[model samples]
Target: MTIRYDLPLWRPPSEGSSLIIQSTIGCSYNHCSFCSMYTNKVFRIRPLEHIFSDIDAGARDWPQAHRVFLADGDAMSLQTESLHRILDYLHARLPRLARVSSYATPDNINRKSVKALASLKARKLSLIYLGIESGHIEILKRIAKGASPRGIARAIQRASEAGFQVSCMVILGLGGREYSERHIAATVELVNAAPPTYLSTLQLDLHRAAAPGFVPRWERHGRPFQSLNDDECLGEMARLVAGVAPARPIIFRSNHASNALSLGGILPRDKEAILRTIAQARNAADSWLRPRSLRGY
Candidate 1:
């Protein structure tokens, strides 16, 4: 059988304002239990020659590729030299490329030194999308993240201090329903240490095929997995956001389609307002659950 090495690309709802680039195809860490983002294909880094060709194509296709986003699970796994060359080529092709961003794992980020990161920033690779997931060590282990919270913190701090607009993702109710408080507390601790410029929360949507760890596809059928109800999930989010100290100008967002509540604003300034919005939704007895009509999918 011929192997297909195509990278699966996806644009979020906000992709309307951004240009998409597939720097690397698929994900290096494809074992996460709750993810199916890259299961359709194996991971592979695109050749520099091919990437440059795509850049040329993009320039011709969209003369104004203002904000570029490298796609798939993570693009930071590319060699530092190759990444730098790609960035150089992107800027050369599109002078209007204001910002470039990509998904990065803790391992990918820490693999490069602070100096290397600084060099990349100078080349216009200004943003990094990190999936910190959760701060709890057990939850990290549960997700097969293959990295510790401290490791994540160090990598994020390195990226941030090196001037990358670090946007880290947090999964609300990640610790299952039982460990929500621990998840919230530990996540807050981690965020406090490596405060990112952007923080996004994705509510857990239990998908059997998307399971990312050692758990069997049928295991969820054997033992029930606990996930927070909608109100509980929102409460957990409120606590996490409210607990964060008013220090930096962090942008908060819930960018995933699975989330019932969509919240975005500059942190500290809109924290209270966001919380009040969630509170109002809860008070109004709104249904956070997708109606049964749509749940059969």
Candidate 2:
């Protein structure tokens, strides 16, 4: 069997080995100033029949597959009944399929009732990747994230209550130098409020295309859009790790390819070590961090 993915499919770093399927065509909300991932395509959900065919082909090719990721931004944006049918089909066709995960926006989760979410979780649609971007409302507005910090916290809490394992992500230099302190404080506040099962941080990549939109916004507001240097970026991440105190145990990771330093471990237990590692990385020369030429979106 031959399998061809929809052009420009994306999955979380942890989903590297999962079978990929496209249940949606593009992001439901693509207006974020920092993102260029789905700007080339329009938002639309794929038909159930087409999704089923893809699953059938996937099962034929990888019968031993244990994990599956629905692609093209937020698959959770699909109607509840649609998601149910897809999950049911996958379970029937792929006996080894243990979990189904997807990127989920705050709006996507908000649109579904808690009961609806629980039902999906019961059917093995277990994990959601949520991009919180920044917990500071000002930064969120600057990035056009279309969500408030309160709203994001509520959505995350709802998902947690529904028994879905949520992996929350925050961008280290999202607020640039202008709002770094407030961004870190607010992000810590939000994370502790709705404590994710996993927390990952990625450095803000000012992709060439995104620069035009993001740069001008800063200029318009008479604020300097000064991105942090490698040392400053690491320092900001260290601050975040030091400040966050989740009630539940949360796995922390700053090992994304875009990061200046790679660190991972359960929080509180490894917090001091992670901060020490960041301090060491900050003292290192620029040559030690990931070079710009080697980075990608």
Clashes of each: 6, 0
lDDT of candidate 2 at residue 196, scale 0 to 100? 91
Winner by lDDT: 2
Position 132, candidate 2: lDDT = 90
Q: Could you tell me every candidate's TM-score relative to the true structure?
A: 0.89, 0.95
The number of clashing residue pairs in model 2 is: 0
Candidate 2 CA-lDDT value? 0.88
Error of 2 at 292 (Å): 3.0
After superposition of all CA atoms, the RMSD between model 2 and the true structure is 1.7
